[model samples]
Target chain A: MTPEQFAARRQAGWAELESHLAQARRGALRSVPAADLQRFGVLYRHAASDLAIARRDFAGQPVTEYLNGLCGRAHPLIYRGRPVRPSALPRFYASGLPRAVRAAGPYVAASLALSVAGVLAGWLSVRLRPDLAATLIPDSLFDRMARGEVSGGIGDAPVAASLIIGNNVKVALLCFCGGVLLGIPTALTLLANGWVLGTLASSIHRDGIDYRFWAYIVPHGVIELSVIVLAGATGLMLGDAILRPGLLSRGDALIAVALRAVVLCVGVASLLVVAGLLEGFVSPSDLPTPAKYAIGAGSGVLLYSWLLLGGRTRRAAAPRLQLDAGG
Target chain B: MLPDLHEIRTADNVGIGYDPAGIGSRFLAFGVDTLVQGVVVIAALVVALALAPAGIAGTLAIALFLLVPLLVSVGYFAVAEALTAGRTPGKRALGLRVIRLDGGAPGLREALVRNIVRIIDLALGIGVVVMFFDRRSRRLGDLAAGTVVVREHRAPTAAAPPGLPPPILRTPDAGPAIDGVEHLGNAEWGALRTFLSRPGMAPDQRARLAAVIAERLCERLGLAPGAPERQWPPELLLERLYLQLLPRMAPAPPGHGMPV
Candidate 1:
């Protein structure tokens, strides 16, 4: 056919498509029922050129296949020249989200290790001079802390528990929200917070808060720290998306990462909220040393265990792209 | 009382396009894409860390400057998908993007809900496993978010046979009708073809297209002259063409012009 003829035909097709689209937008059109499997099946079975030429909205094959599956027929044909039967509702939470988490596992571990080392270094500095708490910690705050007033007085069992809950939640939110600036602020916030944590633990120990600092921290520390690092990791994820949008335009890439970050933040925030309630409400009063150890240890096991094992829910399987020999 | 089945359905005209890459190729592609992204992320971290001090100062520097912005950007992806088109870089790279099943981009609120439910995708770490059993390879995240990831690209196709007649098509019935036209003109047809091949044309131009076709059709079909302002000239032209060469081209209106 001549160029002119092709152009005219193309126009005619597009015009038809537009009218159909507009009608749908105005709610003048409703989805067609999947009553005629045979007709729909024809479209599915021969989708390549025919459907591509016919339907302007079809993106690619996955969509075609998805619609086919949803239609429960061999194919999903256009009814009234509009895509009446689509695949099932789109799945927004990609299965790849976990893969994303796992992909950053090593980075998270390294970040946490750096934090732990910083804490140890801070502790050593405090050991050399017990009264240094007065120097590093504010004098007014030090006096209050020294008297066992804040949370539960350093070694106080109940205070530690409550602190864990509240502190973790705040850290999580900070980590998640700080991504607005592309992760720089969140990273800084985490590092600063970690520094403070390290300094405080060491200072309290120097003040005779009990060398059981390890024991006190070990219980909920795993979950608490993991959540923080995860938040940082998520923040990093967002920033990376912006810096390198890859195939997506910068705006599109940024938006995607931001979405994932929000989800991560929400999850982490919930953790912190739970942690705070534990510290404020449950971790103030003194308990038997054995009970303290038991509670602390129990909490760590439960938290980490939940993180690792929370995937056994009844959701559908993740999408797997497979290739096979050609016909 | 039906005729032999052999006469009813034939596979000879059936067209099938297949991807022979196998599961391994797909996995490798995904891995490569992931690794590239990973390297970039690490590089950003290093830059951030280098700028910050080693102790608290360094840590805070990195967090404030690097980490928070990253998180916020990811949140933006969620919002964009909900607000604009349902796509992210990774998604686009994988040859898969998200869209409301009905059509068009999702709204901002849907984006919020979809991203928020990512927690459910992490349930027991079994979320990823959902893809294994899903027909469309949906994970728990997709299920919770109400989205899908489709293949991003398709291989090229072989050339069409030379000297084949153009596929016969009937004008869409819903639009206004143009009188005094029997067949499409060469220029109008050419323009229509160009419009179809390209993306995003203005509404008024698209609307006026039928009139142009109707004018051409009048020349071809020897129909009466009618004002361009009246009804859809292209539809009338198309009606003439349907009556001539291919009577079966006109199908009953599928009642598809959006619901009233």
Candidate 2:
């Protein structure tokens, strides 16, 4: 048939689909009336077939290009991602984060190893040289340590918490994004952070306030450092995908790993929020040093236990849930 | 020729084409998004400070000052893309949408991954440099997330069929005595129809195109390329010739009348 005749016959349906897509775009397909939504589906299929016919019979024509575009616009809506349920958030924390952490255990171990090596290097160097402490640690922090003031003179707890949360989250995101460069930057960030911590600890020990410093550091440092290591592991996963993408192409491997890594990063963010609150409220509070130690040790054990054991029951129950749904 | 088109086959085995957004448009979109982020951060700080009435409320302002910019910078693109099915406000304004490699809408995970990676992509202009080397103009973020930013196909507001170009006025008797019109094949007839019926052509461009097509057709018909009929405006001559050929030519095929 002539292009005109074909277009004339199908133009109404195409226009109808375009309007329906416009409505869907404004809100969603569900927002359209029930009858129109059904019609939208039929129209989408008809447009897809029309595109196929036009491609075969009318190659290089504007009509084909137009049809291709029409179908492209409709395709995403038809196959859009599932709408997020309210339970998805709670479910992610309860099971998803731990599952991801378990899957990335090796990467996390590597990150921890690097941090430990950095800490040892920093500690031994400062212990031997003593003068290196001034250069290694920031002047403000080093002076504060020299004077035996460990709280960093935080004036407002809320302000300090917000600042800590922002800084830590930024650092974590940087650690995660640094993987795009094959993970060298991610490794360096972890080492540098650990080095700073080690230098501060060594300096505080020189003044014989080691125990007091531990009281201030341990409460928040446990969760904060663990989350940082987790972020580094997330970055390392991306690097590994690039370095050794098993069967998939490098891009596909990175994409697959990134989805899981992002989940870990989200968990990292949440954990940082908790850590920030503890640092601002409990770490500098007038509570007894033992109480502070107990809070730190208790929270660390709880956090690790959750990571290791949180998702197992749900996974074990999955088959039964599926059966119940099927029945 | 049309812009670069990438085609992906759907489950139904039909190819859906997409125009990957170029570096220029993407850069503009990024600028727009950055501007929007700045505005949001500033507005949020202003509101936070305004609500503070001294005493304890002053701490809230201080907290917001520390947090709002960072939160907006990190959350804006990821949250916007996820909620809007892969379009940030800037992308929507610029007619761009992010889609997965398989041509599906991106989910929250994809959005978060890409935007988080965007931190590195923006560093030292690496994203632009990478896009220059990539065929699909994907930056490091898109490469990692397996997503592509594509130009949306905006349907014209008028509901007219795009295939039907402006109709050519018919005046069969006004034609010169063109012998051997039957010598023109389907391809030649299609060229004539497309040139005569195409919409939105500038007069000079239409004249030049008509001259070129008419010259070629005259040569094929064994008529003198510089024949007296050429003195008439090329479009007019082509129109008359088209009318004369209409009766003898077979019905135009599906591809015949449309411009590429």
Candidate 3:
């Protein structure tokens, strides 16, 4: 066959493999358990095979086939005969949930405390002088917030809420992903964020617009902060996996711990989105104090229940899942 | 060929063999062991540095030269083996054994060869590329050392022997020839002693071996088997053989022989 012909076939094979991968992704979302993982391995072997065929070359006639053909061959090898042992499921869940919680516990606690103190300080600063809000927020951002035209700051409640939730999710992701880099960066990021939040809140409180600030912040702060706390926990989990990898190799420990961390961050992000929506649409000032507290406290209870208690009572908890920043 | 019944039976008896752990578990073990050990080493070095701050540079240089290599070797094997050894913490944790082709204990030389050759196993820049392709999961180190890793079987639990009697010491007065046998040279005595002390032979078998040695000695010394056995008993026969062979095996003492 001509080189062009081989290239075309290779392209076609790659397209097929991509489709197969897409299917596997869907399968994974549906929680196909061990079956999906096996299917993915098959796909990987096929992809490898296609790659081998497409790339094979010789002095006379070309030996290699299409790139997709090489992929097709390789895909199966990646996932061959990997039977899901009964133990794997329990192990998977345990690694995902309890381990993340334990590792992130100290970081989460410290960060959460700091963030709360920051917010309180921000409220106090706002109460001290209403004009201070001008100084607390950047002039441009303050103008946009006042005009309800801010794209990224606190004013565009809906978009801001989503962005806040997204950023928090990203932070959680960084925590888990950093396991490969030995979790140092993950911890650093969490502490940095916490410090920033603390300082910002203190500055906001100095502006002397306390009630207004609280009304705007508390509703979502409850959920957003909680998510961040969980994210911090996720980072700690990754670090622990690296620091105390147990009996696994560095690579294996990183991957395993990272996967579990992904699951947690996914769950945390889902809740954060909901909280952001509540905070964005309804300013804390608009709602009665009792109502705001109800939403905030209720969400916290629910999070604790699902993460810590629900796993025992509920038969199937959605496995925590994550996608990294680069992905 | 159809599956053989005997083969099936043997395979069935073996049970599930090695359970390969995935990468995550292996990383955990490596991290913990390395961190713990690294901390201890660092602490000791810190004290050393504090005691004589001036020596810090020299000490560090020495550590780099000597300490780093040892740590690297141990860490590499510990990490790799722990990850793969039934997902346990290296050879010790897994109750598995690694032996050289000659069936000797692993020594510094063996460790050095195996560790140095790991560079080849790495293949290009890909980590452990050689291992993935090689049968038996042997990387370059294992290949160079002619070593194989196998799971150790559990020791069987059984009672002690009931009928076997303890050895008795023969009285010296029973044979004067046996007493004089100590004058024998080393080579002949060594050979005779080795032959007799071997395990699991009946009394008749030992006597027959002794007789053969006695006959040979007699031919050389113009003495009979009866003469050796009657004078020395079985125990001292070896001593007598050695005494007889020394004159032939070794030349005369310095003064008695050619001038030094």
Candidate 4:
């Protein structure tokens, strides 16, 4: 049959299906009327058949292209499935998250190095010229630090913990997301964070408040900073998918790396929460320096030991899909 | 000849195979997304800079300037896609969507994984380059996230309703002169009928096939080539011969409406 004739034969039904689809586009299919839902399914099947015929019998024709375009658009709606329950979050934290972070160890190490480098840069910048602290540290923040009040300046433990969690989580997420910009942003963010700490260190030294600074920071800084570095590592891992995807095409590399990074981010967020707890409560408390140092050291040792040795107990041949970021 | 039946069987046994959205559309969608991100970054910077003078804005300014944009960029895609039917601003503008391999609405987790993959693997210009190699036009993100991109065709095509003939059918004409048909065996008649019913041949090839088959049959029946009494096109003669010889063999028409 001629293309025109075939189009004429199917155009009416196609138009009807199009109308139903238009309504569906406006709202979810479940929201459509009971009558239309059944018809929509039927029409969609008919269109599928028409597409097959147009492809086979009418090769290289405009109708084939039209049907191709039509079927492409409708496939998702027609094949819509019941989304599984949204209960994977807790399980993810319990196991899937840690596995992912462990797999991303190399990225984390790189992120840590960048953060440390940033810290050294900040220290050097401030030590070389104390006046540069004026630009690096905000005026009020600088005044507080010089007055020997860094973490203690913040009031209210519970509220402070919540805010710290929110802030730190935001920072870590940014570091991870920055990898999308080719890892440059990730690197810059990590360095800037380190620079802030370095300037804070200089303030402690110049003000003769080294004891307070260490006492305030050590409690929470270990995990909080580690998580940030981990985030930057993930971002770098993602960015490497772009910079040097190796044998795999860039897309495939990105997919594999992104999955790992996201898994790392989940774990990093949990660590940030723990850190926030310390930052809010332990860091600013009037506890003795030795007690605060002990808590900080103990937590650091426990966390690192778990991260380094915990996964050895799990089966070695865990499937990558255990994380199922696509769940 | 009938085309190959490449069915995509779902759990329910009713699945239509789908083509991926063309790379051009996907690229445009990405472009739109990048543009949106750029605007967001500029706006956030401006807002943070404007708020810098306030004493409370100390850390707040840094968060807004350096941090919020990152979350916004990531959240823009993840949240928009996961919560809103698997479409971001760019995808919506270009009429594309992220769908599961089975052509289902991508769930939140799927959207999250896919976008995360986009940030990692399809970052920079890798996504566009990868489409040429992938069969489904999937970028690294789609492959990693186990998703595919499809052009959204809003119209739902219906199958033929029960008790109704498909919308179009090839006309069934009465058979031609059958006197010569009786000589051919059932197997031969079946082969001819199958060939005659098949579509998608070039006109020249069809005519040549008709001439060759019609001549051979006429020769078999002790008739002359190009006989004036046999007043029909060569293809038509062959078709008529099969139709007359095998009355029981009703070849399906070429209409694409309902499966017979």
Candidate 5:
């Protein structure tokens, strides 16, 4: 048959499918009448079959191109990703986050170790040569310490909380994404942050207000630092995918690890929210030093317990349909 | 024979092809999205600050100033893509949609991952460079999320003039016989069909293009290139050749060459 004759015979079905798709795109397919919904499926299958035939017989023709596009548009409607459920969020916190963290334990440990190395380097450098503290610590912070203030001069708790949250989340995201460059940026970020902490601590120690500084920092620092470490871990995991992609190609490996890394990032973001709240409200408050330390230690325990033990008894959740992102 | 056609097999065993959006369109879309995001953030901050009462409510305004832009930067793409099943305002304007490698709409998780990774992709024009090297023009976010941005097929415009009618071929006995027509590939056949179906060409230009195509077809068929144009006009010869090749190009009947 001529291309025109073939198009004439199939045009009605294609038009029907197109209309159904338009309706589906506007709202949900479920909104369509039952009879029409069934017809939509049938029409889609027919279009799919027609696409196959056109690809074989009418290759390079506009008819084939049209059929291919029709099917491409319709395929996603037929095969959607798993629907979002309210339970998914709660379930993720209870198990998904912890499970992913455990799965990527080695990377996290490496991240922690890198940060510790930075801390030690900064601390030892400052301790050995006190003059180094001038360069290592920011001038505003040093001047504040040189005087008698330990608080961050945050006037409004809510404003500071939002700013802290924004900054922390940005840093976490940067650390996570830096893994694409083979983990160099991720490592550097962790070390740089840790070095700043160490230098500040050394400077505070020299001023004899080390205890006061810890009281202020520990309330939020415990969770904030952990979240940063977790973020670094996610980045390292991405880097590992590039560095040692096992059997898969480098792109495939990056994708495979990214799924879990993103889940960890969500957890990191959640923790940073908590930390930011504490930093803005609790850390700067006139609370007793012992009480602030207690809050820090208690929260750390709660956080680790959740990560280490939160969904151990349950069987794995039913596998939901996850669409692969690659071709 | 279209370039950059990314094909995936569906559960029905049919191959569906997607045309990946190229770097130029995606960059344009990004530009639009950035402008939209900036406008939205500035407007939101203005309204938020304007509404802030004194004392406690004023703190909220300050907080909004710090948080609003960051949230919008990440949330804008993620929420838009998730809600629209793959398109943001910019993408829709540019006729692009994001889909999984397996040709499914991205869910919220995919959307979040894709956008969060955009931090790196947007840094220092890294995404553009990465897309340059990637076959599907995927940036780091797409590679990580396993998704691709594809150009949507535009519906035929009503303003377009009606296509020319198919060329009629004389009966085999009435016309000069043409042989070895099957040797012409789809490329040659497609060129002939395009030449025949197109309208509004100057007669002289049409005759010239037809002669060129007919000569190529003659050379492919092992006949003297100039001989066929002598007996029949080059356009007439092409129309006849198109009709002769039609049956050979028709797909096999169902259950013969159909995908199982």
Candidate 6:
């Protein structure tokens, strides 16, 4: 039959569905009469049939586009149902976060080992010739440390907290994004950070106040350093995809690891907030050395417990993607 | 030609095809979002500075300067994405929305993951370089978050389209005279041919679809519903209907549109 004749017979049913859908979109679906609801299903099925027929008979016509749009609009109402729950957040922290971190554990281990080696090399170089520390430690930062002004001197805890968090997050993101370049950039960023840390340590030791510096850093360092490590690891996964495609092609391998790496980035970013708060207020406070040490140790235990044991209640299955082989 | 179409399978097992927004469209959307974010950050800094005490100095001043603006810039995407339920103002303007592949709404975690990974995409000229390698035109953020940005489909706005000509029936004649076949109309006759043409479907689906077409055709044609002649199933009934209608259905003018 001609498209017009098809429409002539079915337009009334389509119009009825249209009115019902309008009401539904307006959040008035509950008030829609039961009779209309029943008719909506029949109309939707008929429309689906029309679409199939249109593809076969009316191909390349405006009628096909109209049917497709109509079906597209109706499909969600017919089939979509996934309720957002408050419990999902708790579930993610409990199971999703750790499972994600563990999945990228090998990458994280590689990042850790690489950064540690960078650190040892930095320490060795700086210890052998202390003057080289000037190159690693920026002059402004060195001056600030010398004058006891390293905390940005802003009295507002929030301001300090935000700065610390923001800076660390940026560095973490750089470490992560750098992985896109076959991971060389990622490794370089991590090494740069590690070398900087080692140079700073040696410079602080030269001031003969290394003990005091440790007390100031330890509270936040415990959490902050670990988060950076995790981020570096997550970033390295990008490189791993390019470097080791495994059985999958390079593109597919990248996609495979991208999900887990992104998830890890999410978890570690949250951890950075905690570390930032500590660095802002507690690190600068004249709290005794032992108290600082205790806080540092306490956070270490807490962070590890959260990562290693928080989600041990069940073995969550990883999500699997199903790709269609097209005809 | 580039293959930009990707299909999302609904729970009903129907595949819904949507064209993912291309990188060019995405960059435009990002440009809009970034402009808004930049204005917000500047306004915030202005307020912070105007209200601050002159005595403020040292690490605190530097900290506030560095962090608050950064938070606003990044948080603009993450928080707006969540509260807007997967669209920022830019996406809303562009008629784009981030949707979870699994069919649910884009949740907070997915939003955060996608937005954070966005920074990485931004480095490569805002996903321009990365999207080409993806099947769905996804940047790193989308792939990682298992989300896709699709144009929000609009409902049909205009009148229904013109009719199709009657298909020339290829079925060898199915028995002699099926009664009351004239009321079936050209469209109904075309529909029967459609049902006959679909091949290689699973047996059950084919039978079910054939039955539905038969029932609809019977209702439209004023024929007795169901298999009155039990020996001849609906598919066979359909074959007979097409055979009877082919000669009777009128043909349309040449050059009327038909799919190749």
Clashing residue pairs in all predictions, respectively, total: 124, 0, 79, 14, 3, 17
Runs off by more than 4 Å, candidate 4? A2-50, A59-70, A77-86, A136-163, A206-209, A314-327, B1-80, B83-85, B88-96, B99-110, B113-151, B156-260
TM-score of chain A of 5: 0.89
Worst 10 residues of 3 chain B by lDDT: B3-12
iRMSD per prediction, in order = 15.3, 4.3, 30.7, 8.6, 4.1, 7.1
Q: Write the per-residue lDDT of candidate 3 for residues A1-327, one digit (tens) a residue.
A: 323333333444344445444444311223345765665555454444433333332111222212322232222223222233557656645445645565556766755664555555555655566665656543553443454323323334444444444555556555544433454655566555554454445565554656555555566666776777676566566567667879986535644555455556545655666775766565423457667666767776766665565335444434433234335
Which candidate has the highest TM-score of all?
Answer: 5
Return the candidate ranking by lDDT, descending. Answer: 2, 5, 6, 4, 3, 1
Error of 5 at A220 (Å): 0.5
CA lDDT, candidate 5, residue B49? 78
Tens digits of per-residue lDDT for model 1 on B154-186?
A: 321112211123333455442343343335443
Instruction: State how far residue B54 of model 1 sits from its true place (Å).
Output: 52
Worst 10 residues of 2 chain A by lDDT: A144-153
lDDT of each: 0.45, 0.81, 0.46, 0.67, 0.80, 0.69
lDDT of 1 by residue, A40-122 (tens): 33333333233332223222323333322222111112221122122411221133333335556754675566566656665
Ranking by DockQ: 5, 2, 6, 4, 1, 3
Q: Over the stretch B134-208, how does candidate 4's per-residue lDDT look in tens digits?
A: 777777567656678766644334342211122122336645465555677544553464456556778798778
Against the native complex, each candidate's DockQ, computed on alpha carbons, is: 0.03, 0.40, 0.01, 0.12, 0.46, 0.14
Candidate 6 lDDT tens digits, A1-327: 555555665666666666666777322245667887787877777776667766666554546656665665565455432433667778878888887777777888999988887777777888888866777665765663544335444375667687668888888877776676677777887787787777778767775766778887789989998888888998888888878889987756766576557667867878898999898778877778899999999999998888887666554443322223331
- Considering only the true interface residues, what is the Cα RMSD of candidate 2 after superposition? 4.3
Error of 5 at B63 (Å): 1.8
True contacts kept of each: 0.00, 0.59, 0.00, 0.22, 0.55, 0.25
The candidate maximizing DockQ is 5
Question: Could you list the CA RMSD of all candidates, in the order they appear?
Answer: 19.0, 5.4, 25.3, 10.6, 6.2, 13.1
- Looking at candidate 1 chain B, the ten consecutive residues that score lowest on lDDT are B1-10
